[model samples]
Target: AFFITYTYPRTAVSFSEAMDWTPGQLSGNFLLPSILEPGQTYNVRARLETLEDPTQETDTDWGVITIPEAPPEVPPAADIRNLDFGAAGGTYEIGER
Candidate 1:
């Protein structure tokens, strides 16, 4: 039996699942839950049990993983070269030029 656990840093969010192997099963897969956020870091670890005994289990050190962050957005730019400030002080909104 194999037990895997993942935890988000600095919060109470976590997800865990288990897998049991038969006599000939060699591969398994676990789908990530939707509660996890993107670009956030999380700690992960796994424990393997032998003969369903708690005292005969092995655990790995916690590992770090981070999801990719979204790309930045760029605003539109104007190409006006010459501008007149008129007289002294005045409030100007966008596209007032």
Candidate 2:
């Protein structure tokens, strides 16, 4: 099983669900939580479970992981040109427009 921890503001979460596995099963997939934000680093580690011997050391060394920051927002293009609004002829006032 794997665990995830965020240092600042103090949050900890489990990465995988409990499963029944056959002997000799080696690898499996894990899904990351959607609540994780970009530009923040997280700590991860794996733990072993033993059915036969419960007293063994189960935890691995902590590893660092991070998601890259999201891209910047694009600014809109200058659509309207320098037209003279002083030449007002319509019924609408200058403040109304």
Give lDDT per model, in order. Answer: 0.46, 0.49
lDDT, candidate 1, at 78? 62
TM-score of candidate 2 on Cα atoms, chains taken together: 0.33
The TM-scores, one per candidate, come to 0.32, 0.33
What is the alpha-carbon lDDT of model 2 when measured against the actual structure? 0.49
Which parts of model 2 have CA positions greater than 4 angstroms off? 1-26, 64-97
The residue ranges of model 1 lying beyond 4 angstroms of the native Cα positions read 1-27, 64-97
Q: Check candidate 2 and list the clashing pairs.
A: none
Note the clash tally of each candidate. 0, 0
Model 2 per-residue lDDT tens digits across residues 12-97: 33333464443432344344666666666666665554534546434444542333444344578866786556654679555853
- Model 1 over residues 20-57: C-alpha lDDT tens digits? 33332123344465556656655555444454455765
Tell me how far candidate 2 lies from the true structure as C-alpha RMSD in angstroms: 11.3
